[model samples]
Target: MTMSAVVMRKGGLELIETPIPRPGPGDVLVKTLANGICGSDLHAVTHGAELVDGFRAVTGADPFDLNGQVVLGHEFCAEVVENGPGTRGTHAPGTRVVSAPFLLREPQPVLLGFGGVDTPGGYADYMLLSEDLLIPVPDEVPTDTAALTEPLAVALHAVNRGSLGSDDVPVVIGCGPIGLAVIAVLRMRGIGPIIAADFSPARRAMAATLGADIVVDPRETSPYDSWRSVAAVSDPARFGRQTVSFPGFGFRPSVVFECVGVPGVIQQILGGAAPCTKVVVAGLCMEQDTFYPTFGVLKEIDLVFSISYTLEEFGQAIGHLAAGELRVDPLITSRIGLAEVPDAFARLADPEQDAKIIITPNAR
Candidate 1:
């Protein structure tokens, strides 16, 4: 007997029946209840972002061996249907949780899945997760809210990189789900004068609700200058407002976070650095190495890259959702079943939608 999975084929994603995996010793079998449609999933299908590793290996005289493929989701929540025999003091029956989704190959191994890395993910009915990678979902958190654990963890990681000060003016360049999340988490941490930039009015409005002090629509104005009015160093020519001080030419930020993963935006982040500012990196991409020497030499900026969250952060994020400390209900715009994934992908890929689409795999 088998359950079902939403399988991605040559040109599109489809639903298919597959074997229900049996958990071996030390394994945890999860019956997936909900999974978030991550931005990385959009990149995976369109920009070839998901195949960065396999894409690299096949280039320049390497074995063109394309191997295994599985379901496609990383931001998710599941129930422990079957726990392995050797797993004592572990997740018992009826325990629901969110998986880190890594394969758990220890000894300081490679990273995989989520938005940043390439790995098989969780767009299915029943999936296999390592016992260690599973974090308990709080009882007060609904399954859909618990599904947001991964994105919230990522947002927390980005905000933590700020070394955030209470009065510091923080700016987010992209107001996607992750960007809005960064906005939400930064406010929760008491950082103010937050600015969120994106081309969509809907997104900017959403960001405003998420606690952003100002919203910049890249479609109408430059995000950099739009933020300048709020920043101490206001450029009168750009903002049409005077009486604001500049951090000095070639100024860096106290801390800056880059949430939009584009090559040009990457350069902007490096260029926008203020002296002694820490760049809390949070974008996902497969672009080649891009950086300029003058960026560091001219500004004396600190560039730091944060990949993913530890289990502790995951737990904290879950607690926020459970306690209603972090408001995510406004972030989630739509809920759909397995059959609607294709159309869902199309909409999210457009970059015009302001809401995060969550998937309910168990919904029939």
Candidate 2:
């Protein structure tokens, strides 16, 4: 049987016809209805080798090797249409569900996002997966809406590490989807006065809509520029520009979440945080260098790295998003069908798009 898919060819993407993949033992055949184009996909397409799932590095491997038509999406919310032999009977047809993205096995573990480095991705009509990873999407949640669970999982994980409570002042240093989710999650927990920093005014504004107390554009108020002299580097473009053009805002946040994944920003956050303050590197700063342990030791500050989410964690994320505690639907600025995947990726990669963009694979 033929299936429609967004296939990645040499330096470009094309919707091509491919055979539907049958689920293997311990696997379920998921009919992908919605997929989110993650920043990692952009990094891979541009860098030719982005970190798969943020954990392992895959280089010139089978799926990512020179000439393979690798799938390009990581965050997918789909439904189960069929099950393979010996699969658990727990899953049923037409179940509203969001999966863990990858399957695992004994002896060899399945890393949710990165393990797909060698396996076909879920950006197609049918994604094969071992039963252990898939979970019910939940009632009252449409696939387009729940597709956000994956990124939300990430945001929740970061928040969990930040140790943010209703009383803490939280600051997120990036307005990407995950960054925005961080702000929303904090708000849902009754955490107020959250500050969102970004170069994009659109993103900053979106943060405001989501519940950010203040939007700081480092382009104008670079986080490093002493707040006393924050106006020196003040520039509107710093907050929403394509690059980190601003000096930075003040350093009063007891808990800092770095989501931009830029080395300089990470450095700025690390050096500027108050002694004993905690810094959660939410965004992957690939170029970040190790700081002198003495700084952390002397300041009594803590640095934690948050990658993916666990089962319970992912569930908590969906609960908040579904319960309306975390208002995220408004952040979904655009939705397009399969044919628009390429363009969607382009716009998402571009700095102009406003809020989180969701790809409705079957929107057409």
Candidate 3:
């Protein structure tokens, strides 16, 4: 049987009918329920080869082959349809679930939807998932909300890598989905006096709605300096100076999250950071970026890089949504069907248009 899918060809995304992918051993067939358009998906469609090369450079294996059609959807929710051979029926048919977006394999794990000609993602009517990585969704959580497990897990992992202290203030540099997700996770952890910055007023509003104490537009006020309002420093001007900690005075160092993965953002954050602050890099900047090492060295700033989420973090994300601990419903700004996937991609190029867009493959 053939299924409709939005494939990333050499040119761009095209809706076409292709045979429904059969699940391999230790895999299960899943009917797409809901999928979120990720920034990575946007990069993958346009810079397929560059992404592949970067993936190869980082992980030493290229999962996406530009030579063939690629279906791209990583953040998604699906319903179990059938179990493949050599697989135990852990989740029965009709059960709603989400996976890690990786198809466990022999040589290496294949990135589903981005595995080129073989594995398709949630952009289609059906796809394959590893039973080992499947997490059952609770009945109360909306499918769209459950679909966010992947990205939320990403935020959770980034937060984990941060190793935040109770007194450390967090400053999220971008209010995009990842940055907003970081803010949500920080709020969920009860890490307060959260400061978020973005150029777009709409996104800054979203950041505040997600529990950011202070949201600023970098153009007007600097995010690094926004912390001074909440910090109980004896001398506000001395807070971010290049000297050692003043234990007598209440000084909270900033944990700046570079969510805007552009070239100059790191340098900008480094320049604005306080002494001994930790800067967590969560944004997936695909291009070659440059930053001065001296800026970080002079401030004694700890630069940390974060990537995909762990399985435990993924499960935690599901639990957070199921328990309503993190109210992420606001993160989803729009919902579209498979037919509108191509158009939605274009709209997402403008950051102010929407934060997260969910794709309902079978929506009527």
Off by more than 4 A, model 2: 9-11, 50-67, 105-119, 222-253, 288-298
Put down candidate 2 lDDT per residue, 123-219, tens digits, no spaces.
Answer: 6777777777777876777677788888888989898998764445666789888888888888888875676788887888888888887788887
Which portions of model 3 miss their true places by more than 4 Å?
A: 234-250
lDDT per residue as tens, model 1, 1-364:
6776776544356787777766655667777888889886676566543455645665542111122343678888889888865666388867998876665544632233331112234677776677877788888888888888899998887787667766556778888888899999988887767777888778888899999887876677665564556655444332211112433343224567788777777667767544455677788756665778677655566677776787778778988888888987788888998888889998886666637888888788
RMSD of 2: 7.4
Lowest lDDT sum, 10 consecutive residues, model 2, at 238-247
lDDT of 3 by residue, 63-170 (tens): 676767889899999999999999999999999999899999888888886865358898988989999999999999999999999999999999999898777788
Candidate 3, residue 109: Cα displacement in angstroms equals 1.6
Q: What value of lDDT does candidate 2 attain over all alpha carbons?
A: 0.69
TM-score of 2: 0.82
lDDT by candidate, in order shown: 0.71, 0.69, 0.88
Q: Indicate the worst ten consecutive residues by lDDT in candidate 1.
A: 109-118
Instruction: Return the TM-score for each candidate structure.
Output: 0.83, 0.82, 0.95
- Tell me which residue pairs clash in candidate 3: 113-121
Segments in model 1 whose C-alpha atoms lie over 4 Å from true places: 54-67, 103-120, 226-228, 233-253, 271-276, 289-291
